[model samples]
Target chain A: MTTSRRQHTLEVLVENEPGVLARVAGLFSRRAFNIETLNVGPTEDSSISKMVIGVAVEGHSLEQVIAQLDKLVSVISIKDVTGKVKEVHDTQPDYQN
Target chain B: MAHIPTANGTAMTGATSLVKSLEAADVEVMFGLPGGAILPAYDPIFDSSIRHILVRHEQGAGHAATGYAQVTGRAGVCIATSGPGATNLVTPLMDAAMDSVPLIAITGQVPSAAIGTDAFQEADIRGITMPFTKHNYLVTDPDQIPGVIAEAFHIATTGRPGPVLVDVAKDALQKMTTFNWPTSIKLAGYNPKTTPDAQAITDAAALIAQSSKPVFYVGGGVIKANAHKELRQLVELLGAPVVTTLMARGAFPDSHPLHMGMPGMHGTVAAVTALQKADLLITLGARFDDRVTGKLSTFAPNAKILHADIDPAEIGKNRHADVAVVADVKETISALIPALKAALAKNQPDLSAWLRQMNSLKSTYPLGFDQPEDGSLSPQHVIQRIGQISGTDTIFTAGVGQHQMWASQFISYEHPRTWLNSGGAGTMGYGVPAAMGAKVGAPDATVWAIDGDGCFQMTNQELVTCALNNIPIKVAIINNESLGMVRQWQTLFYEGRYSNTNLESKRVPNFPMLAESMGCVGLSCERPEDLDKTIEKAMSINDQPVVVDFRVHRDAMVWPMVAAGTSNDEIMIARATAPDWDSQEL
Candidate 1:
């Protein structure tokens, strides 16, 4: 079967609160997006949490989705790893300085 | 000592380490009942300003919260204690689940020490509410309370926005932990956004540009997203006529020349027959429910449908949408308007011949009703009079049963969200409180709560709320004196054994007298001539709530029914020689 293929990874920063996860999932479920996996964890600082998501999609539509997701109040930042595969997007700056 | 108002606008219980955090998260009101299990969390509420609405019944509290959310377009917050109290909140949670409302249920569970041994007032609330809620969490540790509450609200209001239950042990609320609100949110499974692809919009527009005849099938989403201007622009842009789904009554002005009013089994003949002939059909925000499409296979069979909706499952669940666009109806329709305008500028097809042909089909199947010398006042006639009396912008809410179906069939809505019925859930006894909510939402406009005797009694106690609040919701009860909707089935499908469907309301507190007892002016009409005066007095009254008991035909049945479990293709219309009244099915 012929198919269009593209993939993207995004980092989301969200408030570490109760209903936040449900709200985020609610958005994806509403759009009927099929996600491969989503990993959420606390940052080095307790005030914000980080989430990494991988989604299989068609064309460059990932950018448009990421742009819209970024507009939500709970979302702090988003990075499309489809092209930035070699580097980790969300990280604490090294203390070596 | 602090008085910080919470989400529901009442002052909260006690002081909490997360007082500032809760306040920051827009904690305005919370509906809750207090108990020993909730004492720990109660401490912070007293010091904070978060408000709580102490409810008489946990179920009512949850439903009230649901009503509030439906009107405000926000998440409803409710609280309950362990075991029975927690169980009471479950019904409304499930209701919210099916209706897709945003709800946050905070229940206090037994402390961790007393769990598993069946702690007093302890039941497995988290496990019970798990399948029903969109998501739930159990806070075993005190440190997680702040983050959990914050996350719970976010999740409940986002995405498809269903209720989320949070079970907090007694110890967790009292725990002394530093609270700092998080600024950003992240989750793997949940992300909500409406992004309609430009190409699909173009594809849908191409079909419109090519078809000899096309029609715009509008639904509630046009109003939900406030897309009236865009919808009008597109229909005018493409020069096609418009028809509305039930929820979409107000998208176009009913008086507009191009507007064909509501379409379905009870829809206008023009709307129904035009769909039979159209080559391309553009649907916005409306799901082709069985009521709208009498027989699925026969509904708009010749048309290549381009369906746009915010919900994805609706696209192919019942009817297949050729070019499915999953986005907010307003966003999608707004986008279509411009694209179709561009396409029309380049090449405008001649659809006048098609329009003339559909107009002819419309003339053939005009929507009409009869009041023939039949002694009983027709319920359809009553609704048509309601349509004739109330302006197009009037808001109408119906209790479940024959009355609701009649309103859906006869009345024409000229605005969106003006006609509110429990569409997806079909909950009885929802009309009064919902109409009360509609009055709350639209105070100046005329609001009517169309009810059946059986459904009215279920939530009749709320009539006190209407009188006390002084919100004049015109209550029109189609008193057939039986469980009308169910009786219709028992009469048609079940051999006329008629077990348990009969009404003994007269033996009890007859409905009209009960209205007078509730301090609302009451009127009863059995004759056709009395109908007009009764309705006029009802509209004129502004002092309190009012009820008009129009004694309709006792055995009236809603026609054009698709029996449950039967596919949408088979419909039992209102015709004679059917139901086989002469024989016995049993």
Candidate 2:
């Protein structure tokens, strides 16, 4: 198990419903996982919402967090898109944000 | 069958719809108490087919529901009003969550407009129970009641079952709505993997094939998944020792040769030693709880872990799994059996030496208790007698403390769901009500609540519910007249200060009289000679609930102790005597 802490960005897709964010936020708080930044917005499918969560944690702890997140009935999918964005930015310079 | 207009087209109150939804879900019984906010729902329940057991307290309702669920392998239903009523359910909900009992709690809430304002009898139970429950809902719209009820039951009974709460606003219950049971439920985010990964199964099989000494550390999940049959088959196939945890007292039969007794702080010497010295730990449905593992870092230091559970988060929460299989235990064992048989065909491992060593340890330090120095009746003796007389068909429930441990130790459990307790949460008052619920679920089976004096007083009022409702459960109060477990701790670690642990039970509230007042047959026994006769008398009284108060020694403690925060290697056979681990050769 990797013990060194590193910054990881997790993109969680969830059902757009009342208290969905609270459920996600509550999981982090109850598990004592510190959230650096969290942002949520509606996706192309209006019924679905995407949440980008940033936290500095060990790889093992991050795995645990993802597993716990997967338990929520509202959460659709979770992906650690930490380095993928960087790779895409380096490969396509013409594609600007 | 022709559908009634009330089923779909005709509009009815949400409360009536709720009852219809429950009927559609096949809920035959529910335990609850009615208050102001929940009065509307109770109105419909009067005419419904479902049997509602009116409990004295909301906590009783919750635990009764849990007990019902555990024995029947169905989702138990409980109901309560908002605010204090809902808050009272917190402990039982948490207990059910920790132990993974399938339970549904339907609570009445204040009006939607009064939710944030903290109106009379208002509480945010949905938010309060968020951390503990599997899922929760706050329903304001009357139209959503039917669908939500169906969804709650589905979520509660499936994949690592736990409690689910649906708090409906009072206005919703009063409003007119059409009831329509959903043909199916589709929760997009919730899909549990029942099939084990082929590679993981192969890896586990290979590990089992090579290991000379392996132990099956079983937990409550085995019972929850109803995988005890597969568990026995796998254990026999591998020719390995099996140690059931406190939560899994009967997953493996006590009479079986491969079965070592329960393993934990107060577990048997053979079981604890097996885990401490094993080469491999095949943990099924059981997480490595601190109580079971002792000190995490030092627990089973020589063994590699192969963990399988339905809940993914439990895999590496406390101890890292060398090979983790995320699937239902029943499915895991079913798949692993064939793979392990194939692996054993190529490489047959000899386990005679390991088995011999375990049997030797088992004989050397058997589970037995000495008569108290004070000459008072022994709690162990009473409990053992109760088990012996009641026979195998009985369902035993326990409250937490020395009696709980003794019940686990002395009672010979050969079947799953025969033993129920508040294992994870260790709620003291779980026994009486849980037994009440278990009796309600299994009407023909004899149900016994082996409780401590401290624990009995907490929820003994449920006896009234039992007597009035014709749920005849027998209660055996091991009256030590003090908080026995806490007093044991005081004796061992606190220099026998005693402090506030004493309950003075003998002096205050005569148990037999109290039982009689509650419409139960109250029996009391002080001498060892009277124990069996008293138990027999209690057993004969099937018409009414029975409470047997057996006065026992207060100083008596649970043995085979590994002190809190210590290593399993440091387990003591008695008060100060450690087992001769070096002398035993594997």
Candidate 3:
């Protein structure tokens, strides 16, 4: 079987608690998911934190990564922001023109 | 369920709140060892109603908790101090994680201020056990104790079960707190999907109806979900063969006609062959583990996979599933049964050819070991005899090795939860403590730990815990006088150059004498003629734990071998003999 790797971005909203970031990072490290970039900040709701993670992974492996992330109790929600970014770019009016 | 003490907003220490929270969880028994940091919690435990088994080691406590949880289908609880006490629990926690056993481990941390200051007996247990646990918490506040305990139990026992650790600060336990048991737990992202997708179930049914050679690949999750009856029903309806994995020994009755036995390395020939040649694999609650799949690319190459498990991560983690159903195994089977029946009424696949082929393989290459030419007792015989005499009602726990394999292959488990072992972790020294916990869980049932000489020596100190606590678990030491499985590998791949594999058990640490010193009834059997009487004597001892040292042949090896990272096609039925797959027609 041939597996083609792709870059996917995920938006994860988690509880603003101690070790929450460590839990997410630990999961990626242990499962060996390649993280391209990760950014975490407090959400409008200070109790919740949003993490934007860009990962280089294969099709099935990305699904596994999302599923594993979802299993964490601290994680509130996860959205695949990869396609959404493309949708936004496609719908946007050309500024240069 | 036992009476739970009312909180009533009484002012109490966090230690008292912790003990009260345990009572509220309906935890009847717990296994633990107390030390410096955890001394505060032990005081409340001493006054509490919960029966705490003071194990010699924290590892024993963790394994014992696992044993209790596996047998009783409740969250088993274990307690320990920081540093080494908590670190010792790392193995059992990982073992529980692999097997999906519900375990709640409570550890005492150094004071909150001293957490990162390298205080005496301090360890970052929560950070240490993150990967090994389903979830974990580090409680610094005294008020978080009750809530954390409750949530820990809830998370540990729910969905796909696993170990959860709660590390309470020493000051947190000692500080004054008012306890309030939460009426309900709410974790936004933690809800497990119990009901499977109707479309997925329908798709699986259609596939099953169309398949000619399908096998029900069952796993420990079936037993965990208490879905064995549903599994039996589905298998019978399809008239297909079933192969239980090592972790799922008693998930399906061994006596069932469709049962092809366990599959994987050291698995039955028929079971392994069935998986190798199957057209469709109806995987239920079982991940396609590397051990089971052999070489991943070649495993069931022709088979379309129907993977159903409560854990979504496991669905396509190993093999791609043609029809993936993520839900509780019980619910998945319940929904699939009706859909399958509807599909079968329209077009029933003929499996006569497949059944004939399976039966032929089963009869032709039945599981058996040759009598030792050296006249030493056969370990297989000793384990088989122990199973036969003890009967199917007995709960059998085994340490990892050739003995564990023999126990799985030789024993006929008719019911779920009858067999417990360290399947995923393959942790040795599991048998004795696990059996003690099992016996404690089911006082009336006969519990036996089938251990090897190498394994028995690791946690045999727990036999004292058993003796003192009235557990009365029987232990059968399959003393091969060597690391049997590793030695077998050396014999096979390393040209018999034994390197440190020999335990020299014949010289040091006489097992029976050790057992006697630990306040257990000790029995020794060196000859086949005396095996029955010695086992019977061990069985007859109801007031104390019994350890029987059976001196068996050291040269025996587990057969039906699939070398690690090799294809199942290369499975050897015996020494230098591979079954001719071409000759068997389906």
lDDT of each residue in B1-586, candidate 1, tens digit only: 0333233222222226334545666667666677878766666666656666565557656765666566556667777888999998887788777666778888888988887898899988876775467778878776666566677777777645678887888776665555544555556445655778899899887878888878888876665566787888778888788888666776787767787656665456567656666787788877777767766767777888988877665666567678988787677888888888788777789988877766665554445555645777988888778777876778888878888888877787666567776665677776776676566556787888888888888766656666766667788988888898888878877877788988865455577788888878788888888888888888899788898888887776665455654433343346431222223211
Going through the candidates in order, the fraction of native interface contacts each one reproduces equals 0.00, 0.83, 0.83
For model 1, state the Cα shift of residue B584 in Å: 37
Sort the predicted structures by DockQ, highest score first: 2, 3, 1
The TM-scores, one per candidate, come to: 0.75, 0.97, 0.97
Writing each residue's lDDT as its tens digit, candidate 3 over B360-379 gives 99998889998898788999
| Model 1 Cα shift for residue B474 (angstroms) | 3.6
Model 3 alpha-carbon drift over 4 Å, by segment:
A1-5, A58-60, A83-97, B1-5
Error of 1 at B321 (Å): 3.5
Candidate number with the higher DockQ (1 or 3) = 3
Which one wins by TM-score: 1 or 2?
A: 2
TM-score of model 3 vs. true structure: 0.97
TM-score of chain B of each: 0.83, 0.98, 0.99
Candidate 2 lDDT over residue span B436-466, tens digit each? 9999899999999999999998999899999
Instruction: Give lDDT: candidate 3, residue B174.
Output: 96
